[model samples]
Target: MTSVVTAGGVSVTMRGPVVDEAEAVLDRLVTDGVPASLMAKNAQLWGPEAVEEASRRLGWLDLPETSRPLLPELAALVERVRADGLDRVVLAGMGGSSLAPEVITRTAGAELTVLDTTDPQQVASVVADRLERTVVVVSSKSGGTIETDSHRRVFEQAFRDAGITGEDLARRFVVVTDPGSPLEKTAREAGYTVVLADPDVGGRYSALTAFGLVPSALAGVDVARLLDEAAALVPALHQPYDNPGLALGAALGASALGGRDKLVIADHGSGITGFGDWAEQLIAESTGKEGKGILPVVVEGPDAPGFAEAEDVRRVLLGARPEDSGLGVSGPLGAQFLLWEYATAVAGRVLGINPFDQPNVQESKDNTAALLRGAAEGEAPTVVAGEPALVVGAVEVHAPAELLRGATDLTGVLEAVVAAIPEHGYLAVMAYLDRFADAGAERLRPLLAQATERLRKTPAAVTFGWGPRFLHSTGQYHKGGPRNGVFLQITGESAQDVPVPGKPYTLRSLQLAQAFGDLRALRSRGRPAVRLHLRDRAAGVEQLLSALA
Candidate 1:
């Protein structure tokens, strides 16, 4: 792990399976970009002593009696779903509301297919297929979550198409939302059961609450065990020096305030990817504002994309403090973890914003709606296949040492990637672009800076599609981007594969590539313009990537 002390006097350590690389990346970031103002803000929000004080008072791992009431409710709901004979559960929401449970499920080793995408075909497929054996759980704190509502409509229509409308729709579905929101009314009107999301609990913070519990119950995950695990950390989580979560949270927040605004959560194995995604949505939605935000990044496994050479870009996963270094307990049970959330919550309170209400978050829904509308009207276009595969030109590939030298400039590196893989119609590199490390900064800085320079040098719209969880969120954007998004889709052969039971999709190369192909079609002029391929892993797996770059 490499550690950097922020101007606020908070030290952040970026830990990952690849300690040497991660350390180097952190050192580079601390030296190159963190600003004083941000550090100061972080200092106010996550100072060590303050964090310690907060932990001691909150009893790091202690759950208030008020919060305790939720466990039974959640457990009961699980029994209800199971008793009702539902085998699948679809969580209908975006960002924080959706990510955390999926994370816990994967981490705890539970099997439940989570649908967080808005693609019509994907949505229809999940519903039509899963509805027979599963129960769709529509979750949103605000009943008005446009995306959730859209999903509800899809579900309703699916039921209607199956001639299972009216009471049947209600029986097949349940809702986890605000008690008095429009969603509750809709769920009730449609005849489905409802579970209220506490008004006091924000989406990100609600994970320990029903946000995680409800889905957990449906999946037959041991909610009690997970909670007990969380409960054990209560005291330590609240103590600054002793609480790993608080320590981690403060350090990470301080780092962001210091100018390391991009966070990358690299999962060495199965559980971490979902956790990374969960953390990404939490920080992105909470801390992103007022001329500042921490961009959270998630890398599922070693073979996952985003690993570029040393000179190009490197990935880092922010983790809990020293003492909390055990597998499940390590990442979430430290002072840094608590402090980061506290700092984010405090910042929101200072901003007079309801961190709980993600209002403009609905813009994504509007975009999707507009795209679908356009597609239907023939004004918005459908992704077509591109021409026969084109052969890419070869480029001189540099050694990893040389690559590290150019690590700070991502645009040049990406251009090299494009040149190497020129034959592929679309090229998306999985290089680390998280803001938490110098490597990430270096990785993305060049591309953005180059784009700026290019715009200055010329007037073209330097088009780029950059996102951490773009697989779900920006597929529409990439597939829908002006037929110009070079889709450099990345996938890796998983060390472990979980087949969808009886379903033909085996989570293997064919299905994974098929998913990539769905994204590729967006670049088609009715031709095969998209290229899909795989790597052994994110690190040494650049064998194919280097061949193209």
Candidate 2:
């Protein structure tokens, strides 16, 4: 067993089976000097096609020191935005671009409104809230993500319609993307401030880069301190047994190797608000491919679903202070970012999978693009695969006739889905509704997990991922990692449609298109996935909860 902490206060401990598993992995890593090789940016770390991608994606390793030059400029830009009375910061990005900043701002006790969803009402609420005092940060590593592009377009029109035209309108937005991206060229042409991030860093590994820093800095976080904290941990990473990154990596990799692939992470008053969400993206997108990956389940706490004793599940506790139990972690958010990034990369070595590439994430996006193209070209876009099997209350339950055969109520319909999970399988509850308005949908995760455990006689992992958002994160795991997952998708018809300015499809169309696209992709792989369309958002939530109860 080992407990390690960097000078920056980020610590990792190896507990129980994790401690023994990590010992074996660390022994090999130390003998091979793998940490040193990684620090030297060796692309051959993960063999095969992964070698090519890893070669181009190691820039995140040096972001702590390399990104220092951006601070003064960020300070000036944030000051100017405040000077212009734009205290409200709205981040328009998806996956890594959105998750990183949301975690950073929240941990720093700063407010950054994240617009990662395509839900019409969610976008409308932000648009309607103090537009004069709002400055949108449009972040997209590819510079052409549909969600970010939609957000950018909507806000650009909003700024102009609010009578803030000309240079002021351009100034109302901050563009963060890679150099030479379409967004960079457009920002320059429009006179908007643009911060080009390191093209070498993969989006999920870019927390220390502009994608995470810009929004955090804009929201009044001390950006320099984050860099400093990460810097302090760099030295500790090189040592063998004393390495925190290696310890964590070994635990994650060894656990998965031991059939404990579901990584259930919970915050026990960690004061690190939403760290689990950020980690979920990094863990899932990085490793959840090649049919051999770790499934990161972000639960509410120790009591959340999937936290119970199970052979396939390894529980991690993020607390107010780092624990030596190895199943827990605590530290500064900056150090936590680097620690996990390094550990994930090392875990890739242990699992023999590329941590840098997200091969499956693109499938859903391609599906969505094809669907949206149909609607833009005048075809009636079908949001769901087919009509629902039953309409119970305000919710329409969509599944195969056999699954709902002899099922009359919502509870019986849900029981069919829960009963479908394999002995070690998981149920992913994905809701494509307003995260704020339909927040009650979160209870479904634990409820479903409990129901599965009670009925199936086997403990099952049930995860809740916001729609389209999960399309980038665990969506990879669903389509690529394991075929044992049973999906329950919840979508709603927006009360009003929000347009993406020059785009052909409205936000509602895009949202449903995304939900339907992913569902089709999952079904194409023969995965058991069910959709529950909420015709009336609020009433549907209440009715669904009642059904679950």
Candidate 3:
């Protein structure tokens, strides 16, 4: 069964049994106005002054109120950039800081390039030509994000190399961070423009805050109109039954409880193309905890092949315009951000967890820091190489027997693993290769889908994530949340290396360390994981595709 509902300019079409399960909860929430009460100033949702006092951190609930007065400031910054003739904006941040800006720039067609990866190749690509005309926005809520700091240092030198120095160098940079964060002081000391983010807001929920707005403004998006559209949905969310947020929340939570834990997003048009990555972080980090989670599987589009037989998946089709027989709407991109935030909060309540806190996110960070420290102390971490390579059509590939039992090649291994996954389980391809490489982990999607359909006689969701980057996003959930994932970690040798600014190691070394560190962390958590070492990225991709085909 399918149904479509439109509210606040956005239309959602619900499909599958999850919709039926969600309606009962939606009815209760609407009648009680639970989600709306959470939005009230200083209101308590979790309990009396206990978690309630902590819920003050829920400033994202009232972002419109906080952001309304900052409109003039945002507009003035946009005008200043245009008047100064800056041609590009480079945002350097991680996770929440980077995802929103990246989506905004891509969707709005703004001249902004996000530098989120620590890959030297990725970093070099950003400053290859536009150092002089680019305004670098260094964003980090904690102001101490190692990646953002490294990026800031790297680009600061790039500006210096380009002959921009001292106070003039400050003109080419802006810092967005919490008011009293270390980055704020550093920016002030260096005379760079500083935009203070709300301290009460968490990074994942800070999309409507200065963290998201500054970059959106720089990207030529009409920030005021975006907020206005988002604000329009607030009243609708308060209504309960007709509330879009409540409906979305109920659907997601109920679906996960019903064994449809995979939330597959299918965008019908380019309007919502980049939104999946942003939503992935929100849903995964928010609801994924205490040995339970809702995995977000973002597909290319509705017509994407291979998932037709997936059973543990729920499909969401995001359309810019309404379909003839289903739901549709026209709303600013900002409205979607607000809608998801509200929906995620509601889902958290449904799942009985704190959506605001990411308790396990720190584990991998600590592991990475330890690895770096060990290297600095002359105690290099052991590099475990996968052995007994399987020969597949002239290419030798390394994969674990658990992932390829009774298999002589990569294709057989994929089939064996797909068959081995328990009912309702998922496959996660954790790739540590460079994002620029076409022969990476994502290529295995279709094969996994095919294997799931053919061998399991059920649909299984497939997920692809780049290493170290996902550490800040879904990594927490993978380790601390559910035991539903069967991981295939992909790694390859770097063709070249670039040294970290002040470290004895290169960026490639850092990446490998992070990958190894995360692998160790997952193993320590008893996660079912296997490593595949490719003969360089391209060959690795080619061999995997050949084997699967």
Of the candidates shown, which would achieve the greatest TM-score relative to the real structure? 2
Candidate 3, run of 10 with poorest lDDT: 321-330
RMSD of 3: 2.9
Better of 1 and 3 by TM-score: 3
Instruction: Indicate the worst ten consecutive residues by lDDT in candidate 2.
Output: 319-328
Model 3 lDDT tens row, 1-549: 665566887666665565587888777666666866866633445445337434646788778668887789878887887677776888888889988877777787776787777676667777776677788899999999877888888888878888889877887888999988999999999999898988888888888888888987887877777678788777776665567777778777777777767787667764754888888999998878888788887777666654342556666657643233222233567788888888888777777777777888787778778887877777655444445457554344455566567787676777766776677887878887767644355768766776676676666878778776787788877887788777777766666666666666667666767777787777788766767765566776887887677
By lDDT, the best candidate is 2
| Per-residue C-alpha lDDT of model 1 across residues 1-549, encoded as one tens digit per residue | 443322121234434332343333334333432222222333233344344322322221233233467778777777766776776777776555666677667766777666554333344456667566667778877787544665676667666667876665677777888668888887777678887755655566666556666776777776665555455444443332333333344444444444443444455422233465555555556554333444444443333343221211223434433222111123332222333454444443333333333333344344444444444455422232223132222221222333223433333444443433222122333321211211222233224323333333321111122222343333332332223223333333344433322223222322233343344343233312223222233342233334323
**TM-score of candidate 2 to 2 decimals:** 0.97
Off by over 4 Å in 1: 1-67, 163-166, 269-273, 300-549
lDDT of 2 by residue, 214-296 (tens): 99999999989989989988888877757788888888998898899998898987778999998998998888887888998
Model 2, C-alpha of 370: deviation from truth (Å): 1.5
